[model samples]
Target: MFHVLGALVFTLVGVRDATWTTDGMAAALLVAGSIGVAGNVAYGFDSVHVALGDTSLVDQAGAAVLIKPLGLFFPLTMLLCAVAVRHVAPRWAAVVIGLSALAFPVANIGNIPALGVAVGVATVVGFGALAMRPVRSPSPATPAASAAG
Candidate 1:
């Protein structure tokens, strides 16, 4: 998913955030969210077969395992990623990422009188491009290192 790829851009930050807790938590949330998304899609497809009065107990179980991980874990992952990005990237990159995140959801309002989903998606693509730079944060200056150089 785009969100996960976007999150990976913050890996350097996640590892170097002066705390291992964030890195561990981000990894946990990423795995949980990914599993949740895969499972949700699997269950959703199975549940769809129940619509034509051809319900099976196994297929019907989709309703039970549907929303939790997707609703809870995925957003948490995004939040973690956003926080991670803030520490490593410039302020403007943070703003662009934030805008792109918001753009995805607003894109669903396709029939709105003024703006359309296309505009929203375009915003995400454009802003995401601006935000995703390849460089990691430069190492901090140390007296010995600076003197040596």
Candidate 2:
């Protein structure tokens, strides 16, 4: 769900000025979001199979297989945008983005999904900031008036 929202935000931001970094992030989110949706379906399917007294056909690993790639894509998404934000955003934002990028992959590693969720919220906020940031354009050169001799 978060990634889906992110994709929309990035797409809207892209309308202002498209960049390879932003466009690539949006594409990654789209792909990862699709995988997430399918993983969710697999999760539900596993549950249904268990409820129907037919656990033999369900591979518990299937859900993990589909969902675990998010551990890769989420951070990739964050870091990619982080590179763009590193210069434009405030120092604190840059620090947060960097730490978020490094920490996200491990947030859920130790059964700390609460931490993962918190990081996820931060990711959303970080992305929102990126999307809302005003674009930077080169300033036009103005010739100084020549002093009379």
Candidate 3:
């Protein structure tokens, strides 16, 4: 996930260097990366808590009233990544951003660990493509616009 966020930052920087001069998009990328890193760390802690079978955080209502806030940030961070990527690289962006968007639902719905892995992989590859330099070649004219013949 962090790798995905990092790729997003690279994409934003690449697009800005090529198209516009706005720092807002670049800043957004950094912010999203920071948030994603933090959220994933928190999620790791939460998973540990669950593994330990420590349900003390939740009440009899079967609600994790305490950990809910921390968990919420993870999805929100992912959403930020999606929005930023979509705005910067709309082309081929869906391959990554779409998978990321489905990560949360897929994780919770089917409880499939592979879904999250796939999303991360897609993000890295998609954004990596965005960072590639455009292919260019000199005009097929002679020396001097064909030597101004």
- Which predicted model would earn the best TM-score? 2
Tell me model 3's lDDT, rounded to 2 decimals: 0.49
Model 1 agreement with the true structure over 1-149: per-residue lDDT tens digits: 44344444434333333232244555664565465445434434444556556664343455644543343443333344445455455556555545544543344223353343544454354336434656344334533224335
**Candidate with more favorable, higher TM-score: 1 or 3:** 3
User: What is the alpha-carbon RMSD of candidate 3 to the true structure?
Assistant: 9.8
lDDT of 3 by residue, 19-129 (tens): 321255445545554554454454555456667986434332444443445444444444555544443354466346556655765664466888767766775566455
How many clashing pairs in candidate 1? 0
* Over 4 Å off, model 1: 1-22, 39-65, 99-123, 130-132, 138-149
- Deviation in Å, model 2, residue 74 alpha carbon: 1.7
lDDT of residue 93 for candidate 1: 56
Candidate ranking (lDDT, best to worst): 2, 3, 1
For model 3 the local lDDT of residue 126 reads 60
RMSD of 2: 9.0
TM-score per candidate, chains pooled: 0.41, 0.49, 0.47
Which order, best to worst by TM-score? Answer: 2, 3, 1
